[model samples]
Target: MKQQDNRALGAWSRSSTAVLAAVAIALFGAAAWHLGTVALSVAPPNTLSRHYPRWIADHIHPELEQNWKLFAPDPPQGNGQIEARVRTVNGTGARHTAGWTDLSASDIAAVRSNLLPSRTDQDLLLYAWDYYALWHDQLPGHPREARLMAANLKRTALQRLMPQYQGQRITGLQFRFRFDRVPPPSWASPTTTDRPVNQVLPWWRVQNKDCQGL
Candidate 1:
């Protein structure tokens, strides 16, 4: 009788542990699913708003449109903007303000001319471009390539920025992209809080102002 009771107790302990482990796994899975849903809701997959022009378009209901303001906006207005500032070593090895600009093709060329003229500097600039491209969704070749480029750009940008840090640290060379909702024209304001303009425009309409020409 004593032996049977001991055996039963041991079996019950094992069963309890198994049940607890199963419950823990279920809880973890639920949490993971919830987090994934939230992320998807905030930033939908494959929206043009989430990627650059010229990349593969997501075939969903709303296609993405390209805005030149991303690179070279005339008077500059758009969701994607790159602002670059540079500091460089002066002849006396003291740091001086090199320059700053919104990153257009011209701006990129200027930065290359001023700071990264050497092979090393060129490499760093390439890295920075790749890094920016990844965020812009311009990288479509290979995931590995994008990853490598982002890493290299971060490393090179930091290396280039470090030598020029004077008593005042180089504080503000940053890149950011965001979603901006266009406000309704005065005529349409009374009807809605949401802007009437399409969040994603067609590819043809992106750069071209005349819809008829498109």
Candidate 2:
């Protein structure tokens, strides 16, 4: 009878140990799952600006307030105000003459369009072109130095603009910077030679519009 009792106690102890082991495993699994969920919920730091446009404007226009203070004293009255004229590809033009402190959504949209890839590679190509133009004007007839300056400007502009966003999806459209020499056929005089050509060598033209107006 004593031998049978010992056998029953041994069986109970073994079963209890097995049950505890299973419980421990389940608890551990639940804890691991909870930790993983918390990790996924947390967003990566500095992936995106808290206020994207304001942040961008701050970076782009650091002396904006100072400039406004200087210029606001003699604010342009009525239709004589400094106006931003946006010329679209379709020959339509829209004008905005709001104060610098009051930038409307339309103004922001127009600015964004200038930087956008679909409209033009303004961030990359235009930056390089403008730099080349400025450098060439400063030191005329120096192709090697002009090329180096343009390249450096391009690299700096890309570094400033091409920031990686965590949740934002980057498409092939965003990466596109391929420039075509073909001008739109709707121009008044469409000639093969009249189309704007990418100068193999940077040359300063007096007719070039000042990009600082942006």
* Alpha carbon lDDT of each predicted model: 0.45, 0.39
> Where does model 2 exceed 4 Å of error?
1-110, 113-125, 133-144, 165-177, 181-187, 193-214
Decoy 2 TM-score against native: 0.21
Q: TM-score for all predictions?
A: 0.27, 0.21
Segments of candidate 1 deviating more than 4 angstroms: 1-12, 15-96, 99-128, 137-156, 174-214
Cα deviation at 106, candidate 2, in Å, is 17
Which 10 consecutive positions of candidate 1 have the poorest summed lDDT? 201-210
Clash pairs (backbone) in predicted model 1: none
How far residue 2's Cα lies from its native spot in candidate 2, in Å, is: 99
